[model samples]
Target: MIDFYKYQGTGNDFILIDNSKDDFKANKVDYAIKWCDRKFGIGADGLIFIEPSTKGDFLMDFYNPDGSQSFCGNGSRCSVAFAKFLGIIKDQTNFEAIDGMHQAVISDKHVKIEMQQYGAIESIGNDHFIDTGSPHYVAYRNGVNENIVEYGKSIRYSDRFKTKGTNVNLIAEKGDRNIEIWTYERGVEAETLACGTGATACGISFAQKHNIDKGIIEVKAQGGHLRIHLEASKNDKVYQNIWLEGPAEFVFKGVIEDEN
Candidate 1:
């Protein structure tokens, strides 16, 4: 049997395994597919292994349900919370993810992680594309409707991104420093309740368009609320000091029979 803990951040859930001892040796891709199946196993958007890290507090090895790898924002936050639960760190921590190094802080259930600096946003036709750890295609709409899955698939599988695929986000400006967002994750191939990188991308896109120098952008996702703090350069293009903050909560824990 394999012990695991389940965690969620704004409804983007994950199955977390403590591999710091390096005892689990099953194929990750195969297990990620098997364990993430809703009907067959512990359902989750992804799977993460907390491995020992020489460079930082821990190493976040994350994989999407489909076995694809990427730098996940909410997954990273959950990893931080899990690290604390395991008595790895206190309030602050620096960790290594697939993207590189990241710094995070935990206060109760709320976790905030610092994102890497991003360059100018790329305009594709009328939409926008930005890589906030994960590549996202942001479309500004009057309102986020139910057609997100269909519309998102059209863009995600387009010639430009079909090779590797990209996360699609439909966003609508709510008011000053606030926006509503819906995300279609590439690996899941469906609309998730929330997406961390997608929310960050929408916030940055809104900031660049509105020429906001520095402030917090409130994002309302289908699952919950997230706050994005950013500081834009004088040109209103380059962005730095970006932080993604939201609630990372423990859902449950159990042991699963090793199918491998």
Candidate 2:
């Protein structure tokens, strides 16, 4: 049996296993695809392995339900919280993900992570595309009845992004500093309650479109609220010192029989 902890940031849930001792022997990709099944297995948006890191406090190895790998922001937050639960770090930590090293701080259930700096935002008609560890296409919408999954799939599977695919975000501006967002993740291939990288990309796009160089954008998603802080330089062409803050909660812990 393998011990696991379940966690969620906003509503993007994950199964976490502490593999620092190198005890997990199953093929990670196969295990993620099998265990992340909603109807047949533990059911989660993704799976994460917390392993020993030579560069930071720990390494976050994240895999989507489809067995695709990426640097997940929400999963990183949950990983930080899980690390705290395991007494690996106190209050703050520097962890490594697929993107690179990241710094994070935890206060209660609220966790804040420093995101990587992005160089530019690609314009796609009225929409925007940016990479915040994960690639995202942000489309602005104003209160309309539409099937998000269908619309999102159109863009995610479009010829431009069909090869590797990109996450899609449907966003509506609420105010200068607030916005509502919905995300369709590529790897999960569905609309999730929230996506941290998508939220960050939308926040940055909003800032660029509104001519706001530095500020916090309150992002309201289907799952919960997140705050994105952005600082831009060189006439808002490069964004740096971005931070994503939100609640990461521990749901439960259990043991699973290693079927592999």
Candidate 3:
């Protein structure tokens, strides 16, 4: 049996496990696939393991529903909240993830996380590609309809990204500093409620296109709202000091009765 806590940030849900003691030994990928199943298991977009860290407060081990390892923005925020629940940190904490070190602050009802600096961006046709902690493809459109899943899938599994796959974000500008995004995550392979890294990547992509490098942008996802703060990097196309702020709520806690 495994004790787990479920949490969600902007509707991006995760199954969090405290493996700091190194006693919970289970095949990670297998468990991720099983527990992330909505009908068969715990039902989450991903799984996060809180383990001991040498470089920071703790180590965030994140896995997708398909059992692939990836850096998740909302999952990272949920990890921060989980750390607080475990009495590991107070108001603020720093943790190491697959992407590297990240800092987060716990607020009244939200958690703000600092994303890594990205310096590489390529414009492929009308779309933009950027790795905001996670590889993402940002495409602009007028309205986000139901066909986004099919459109995003075509691009996500296209020859350009077929081998590795990439998250696809369909974005539409609402107004100055406001944008709406719908993401088809790679591992999830479906349209999720929201994606932190996808929103962050969208903010940077929009900034580069319009020449607005530094500022806060409001990103509306299907789940809820998120705020992304970006600072101009030394390079013309790079962005730094990117912060993702949103609400992460505790859903429930339980022990898995069956492990078979």
Candidate 4:
């Protein structure tokens, strides 16, 4: 039997298990789809199993709701919280994600995640393409939820990203330093409340498009609010510290002897 905890960051929720001994084998996609079922199972956007790492503090082996992906950003934030809950690390922690090893710091209520530095943002037809550990299509709009899903799905399922459908993010600039965002995750096939990497990508992409320097930008999502702090860089080397601060309350803990 395995004891697991549920955590959510701005509505992009997940099921987490502390597999510190690497004794768990969840290599099947059907398992994730079944476990992530909202009505029939634990109900989450994805699932994560933490294992002991020889290269870092921990290793986050994650999966999407569709039982496909592993490098989920919001899931990673929840995993950080879970790791803290298990006393695996302290205020600061480092873990290897599917993309790579990520560093983060846990405050009283907020968590500041230091993401990896990828390449410069790319411009698509009417949007910019950036990979915040996961591919994202960012389009600034006056308001989201207006056919954004319909508009984003074409791109998400298109040959460009069909193999691993990309996450769609719609961002609306509020003020000089605030923004409202809505996201459509690939695996979940809907608009989730918050997307940690999506929010992070939009924050920096917005900064680049607007030419804003270092500042804290609020990303208001359907689930809750998240804060992003970006460091303006020259020569397209922008670095950032994103905080997916929101509810990570425990929902329920139990054991599943038979994962059927």
Better of 2 and 4 by lDDT: 2
Candidates in order have lDDT scores of 0.92, 0.92, 0.91, 0.78
Q: How many backbone clashes does candidate 3 have?
A: 0
Question: Candidate 2's residue-wise lDDT over 1-260, tens digit each?
Answer: 89999999999999999998877889999989988999999999999999999999999999999999998989999999999988889999999999999999999899999997455898889999999999999999978355779988999889999999999999988977899998999989999999999999989998889888888999998999999998887856568889999999999999888763
Cα error of candidate 3 at position 14, Å: 0.5
lDDT of 1 by residue, 21-51 (tens): 8888899999999999899979999999999
**How far in Å is the alpha carbon of 3 misplaced in model 4?**
1.8
Candidate 4 TM-score to native: 0.92
Indicate whether candidate 3 or candidate 4 has the larger lDDT: 3
State TM-scores per candidate: 0.97, 0.98, 0.97, 0.92
Q: Model 3, residue 255: what's the lDDT? A: 95
Q: How many backbone clashes does candidate 1 have?
A: 0
Which sequence of candidate numbers ranks them by TM-score, best first?
2, 1, 3, 4
Q: What lDDT score is found at residue 247 in candidate 3?
A: 96
- The residue-level lDDT of candidate 2 at 260 comes to 36
User: Mind giving the per-residue lDDT tens digits that candidate 3 earns over 1-260?
Assistant: 77899999999999999998877677999989999999988899999999999999999999999999989999999999999999988989989999899999999769999997465888889989899878999999967664778988999889888999999999999999899999999999998999999999998888888889689989999899999998887787888888999999999999987563
Q: Model 3, which residues run further than 4 Å from truth?
A: none
User: What are the clashing pairs of model 4?
Assistant: none
- Among residues 3 or more apart in sequence or in different chains, the pairs in candidate 1 whose N, CA or C atoms overlap within 3 Å are none
Error in Å for residue 103 of model 2: 0.3
Candidate number that wins on TM-score, 2 or 3: 2
Candidate 4 lDDT over residue span 1-260, tens digit each: 66778887877778887889877775547667877898988888888888888878998888888887747767777788888888898989878888887888887756677765477788887688888888888887885547767877877988888887788888888888788988888888887878888888888788788777677777888788888777776655456554444445456686756442
